[model samples]
Target: VLAQNLVIQSSSEIRKPGDSVKMSCKTSGFTFTDEYIHWIQQVPGKEIKWIGRINPWDGGTVYSSSMKERFTMTTDNSITTAHLQIDRLRGEDSATYYCARDTMSNQGYLPYKNIPKQ
Candidate 1:
């Protein structure tokens, strides 16, 4: 099985739609760039939500299908931080944002054996 971790990303600013926003996730269980970082948003009265995510090693981003084209995601491996920027202001942009990263070990990550198993 793969290993797992829990990282809490904290931010000091609440960004508007047109303003740029960034957050950082410091891993406590493993190395920094070995995994992926994901961003989420939950409304005032809703369950877990998905907004976007970024990969630190290559600075890759994946946004939700329903999100507008304005949302942007980026990451800096050197600092172990992820950034979420949304351009153009809109009332709907007001939300509680969350940032998360994939643990080095996952629940189903298993290695193969060199030989057949009995």
Candidate 2:
């Protein structure tokens, strides 16, 4: 079997509060729609934070309370890509970000597969 990996295209974004930003994640060596895509966050020197997860097949999303109001998750299966957009960003929103896949296997959700910061 081949190894699968998630690739995040954006790395480190600097935006002021109230501004909007979009980041993308792409998958390789696996069925893009077979699992869910999750977005994570980390401050300059803080622990990882769960932003939300998106079902690429149907565009369904579930967000954490911290991001529910200001964040949106989306995917385009045709392009094998997922996206996370932050709207009306807050001062505390400045941080490094990442994307991971919900393998749903014994290993569970795998994070930091692609440590894209934004």
Candidate 3:
């Protein structure tokens, strides 16, 4: 089988706490709808945070409690893309973001299998 990679893209911007930003993840070399796409956040010199995840096939999402109020997860199967939108950004929100595939064979499991970015 050919290897596949997940590509994430977002423009860096300077904004205040109330501002919002949108980031995207596009997949290549595999069936995009076959896996779940997850978003992650990392503040400078801090641990990684799990933002949320989306099912590309149906657009369903589940977010971390810490992120429920300001983070939204979405996906477009037609474009093989996933998106993360953050609203009311705070100073603490300044960080590097990433998109990764949830490679767990069983959806019932909670541990991340592997994260390719951030």
Reference-based lDDT, each prediction: 0.56, 0.72, 0.69
Task: Name the top lDDT candidate.
Answer: 2
* Candidate 1, pairs of clashing residues: 3-105
Model 2 regions more than 4 Å off: 1-3, 104-118
> How do the predictions measure up, each by TM-score?
0.65, 0.80, 0.79
Which residue runs of candidate 3 sit more than 4 Å off their true CA positions?
Answer: 1-3, 104-118
Of the two candidates 1 and 2, the one with more favorable lDDT, higher being better, is 2
How many times do residue backbones clash in model 3? 0
lDDT of 3 by residue, 10-100 (tens): 5565666677877766666568888887877776688878788888877888889989998998887888877778788777877777777
Against the correct fold, how does model 3 do in TM-score? 0.79
RMSD for each of the candidates:
12.9, 3.9, 6.2
1-118: candidate 2 lDDT, tens digit per residue: 1135746465656666678888877667678888888888877678778888898888888899977988899988888888888888777777667777776422433333232234
Better of 1 and 3 by lDDT: 3
lDDT score for residue 60 of model 3: 82
TM-score of 2: 0.80
Candidates sorted by TM-score, best first: 2, 3, 1
Overall local distance difference test of candidate 3: 0.69
